[model samples]
Target: MKLTREEITAALVGLLGADSVIVEPVRMDPYLREPRKRFHQPAAAIALPHDVPALQALARWANEHRVPLIPQGGNTGLVGGQVPLGENEVVVSLVRLDKVRALNAEAGHMTLEAGVVLETAQSLAADAGALFPLYLASQGSARIGGVLSSNAGGVQVLAYGNARELCLGVEAVLADGRLYQGLGSLRKDNTGYDLKDLLIGAEGTLGFITAATLKLFPMPQGHETALCSVNSPEAALALFYDMRRRAAGTLTAFEIIPAFGLDIQLRHRMLDRDPTAGPSPWYCLLEISRPAGGPEGTLMAALEAAFESGGVDDAVIAESLEERARMWAFREQMSECQSREGASIKHDVSVPIAAVPELIARGSEAAVNLLPGIRPCPFGHMGDGNIHFNFSQPVDADPKAFMAGAEPIHAAIYEIVVGLGGSVSAEHGIGQLKTGLLASVKDPVALQMMAAIKAALDPHGILNPGKLLPPSP
Candidate 1:
């Protein structure tokens, strides 16, 4: 027998103190709404567990009563993974669990609770004379738990790695209130099946990531940043090859941006001035990190070679730290600048590095054929093959109408992505938005395997129901 809403609230208040349970609808608003504003559903109550024991008790009670629980971090997830799906579920906000358990900077690792803000973690590493290379726009609010759950990838993924690669291990609470104490700082743990990797990208479907031990690196002495003009994506790719061949591991970031990106940033006054050298069809923002005793002018030497080979026409290397910041502002503001234009159809897809130019050409043509005058803004980590393919509505077009007819555009881009042996959803995991798409494209055997894993861990189907995995036929 299912409990009524009032009964559920009372039961929660009984378990945790009345102060920890929020029954007011207004107070529950923040936990229900996500970044994309796509998924909106009421939650029974917001449960605030102050410590691991409290969270474990809540999970055990939830399992017994079959109450669906949505584990949320700082509530900054792009997908609906961190929000509630229906009125029957309860959102477990982990903000109060913020704590720094251990920090061995010299040893290159630190253990932090799930609620520790990502930016705070970065500051902690810096204070210890080390570096945490995972940098994201949402790092100001995104927590370590959701970061690991989604396996987030940001600008530095080209050199360091994604959230999964940066994490050494995780400590989680299972569905039945048992603890999976897997946190460690070991560089080598050739043990049995790697449960750490399995839970890191599970998106809260497997368990609630309570804490984690993350990897750190030595701080770079300095950085070499530049924005270069490339005639086309092919030229950018050639330049990237030359840079990688020359700089090797020092080539930290290689981002590509179309001319339109710069235009809108300037038009909206998002930037004080144009950061590129001059107007060109495309631009590549490349950066190389200089070690403590490393030589400088590596980027300059590579650009000279690139210019002679006709891969680059013009370029502007940052002469000061302020110039470097402006160069990055141009790239980081790409997504925000598009919203000022109008409604945009976006696809976070990725293909092979060599096929990026082809992906952009074919995708732009396909979108234009379907909806003429559609502005395509394809830019992102070109070095890692993940392009944030987005299309803005035509001038003076109705936002609602444009969004209503977005099906064909989405279909066209995903089809091209799949045809080129690319992932339909890159970086961002298949939160409720792409479950159906994942079902259509994912291998059947792989889906079955995922289902088996879900059943083995969460038999009651209470941990983030109707997420990550597709519905049963």
Candidate 2:
């Protein structure tokens, strides 16, 4: 038998007390709203547990009643994992559990509760003379648990690795309320089955991440930033190889932005001033971080060599911190600026690093062929082979009608991405948005393995139901 909304609320209030529960539909708006605003289904209730014990109790209660629980932190997920699908599900928010449990800068580790905001964690590390190295656009609102659950990748991935690599250990509350205390700061643990890796990118399906021990890095003295003009994606690829040879581990970011991206941003007046070297068909935002007491001008020398060899046409190096901020603002604002243009079809897809040029070339050609007037805005972390392949609707076209025509555009781009040995959902995990697509594209045996794991860890199907893994074939 299914529980009514009133009965569910009563049970939740009894377990968590009335103060920690929000049953009013109007009051749950913030928790229901996600960053992308794609999935906006209502949840039955929002439960804010104040501590670990309360969280465990709520998990156990949900498990017993067969109630679906969506684990949310900061409500900043680009995918809809933190938001709800069915009105019967309850959102378990970890915001009240924010805390910095411990820190050891010399030993390069820090323990933080799930609800602690990413920006706060970075500031805490900076105060202790270390760097967290996980930089994301939504860091101000995104939290540790959600970041780990999503296994987020940002600009510094080339040097620092993604969220999964940055994390040393995790403490989670499983579906049946059993606490898994796997928080160890050790670098090497050959212990059987890496549960931490499994939970990190599980998207809150296997367990509710409560807290984590994160690896920290020595704070960089400063970053060398530059905006370079590339004649083609081929040239960008060649320049990347040369820079990698020179900068090595010091290379932090190598983002590629198309001329169309700049045009959109400029049309929307998103940037105070143009940050590129000049008007070029494409631009590559390159950066390299130098540790304290390390030599400077490594990035400049590499760029000089590339320019002499005709790998780059021109470049502008950041002479000050303000200039550096401007260079990054141009890259980070790529997504938001698109909104002002019109309805846009977007994909966060990735391919092998070496195949990036071919992927972009072929993907753009297919998109153009699909919709003749569609404006392609392909840009992002070229160093990681992840491109935010987005297309803006025709100028002055009806957004509703343009969106209605996006089906073929999406199909064309995704087909090209897959054909080039790429993933449909790269940085963004499969939430409600891509569940069906994941099932179709994922390997059959791998899908079965995921299903088995989900059943074993969350037998009741109570944790973030209908996320990450697809149903059996």
lDDT at position 16, candidate 1: 88
Indicate which candidate wins on lDDT.
1
TM-score attained by model 2: 0.98
RMSD of 1: 0.9
lDDT for each of the candidates?
0.93, 0.90
Task: Quote each prediction's TM-score.
Answer: 0.99, 0.98
Worst 10 residues of 1 by lDDT: 77-86
Q: lDDT tens string, model 1, 39-155? A: 989989999999999999999999999999999998887778888888889999999889999999889999999999999999999999899999888899999999999999999
Q: Look at candidate 2 and give me any clashing residue pairs.
A: none
Error of 2 at 180 (Å): 0.3
| Regions of model 1 farther than 4 Å from truth | none
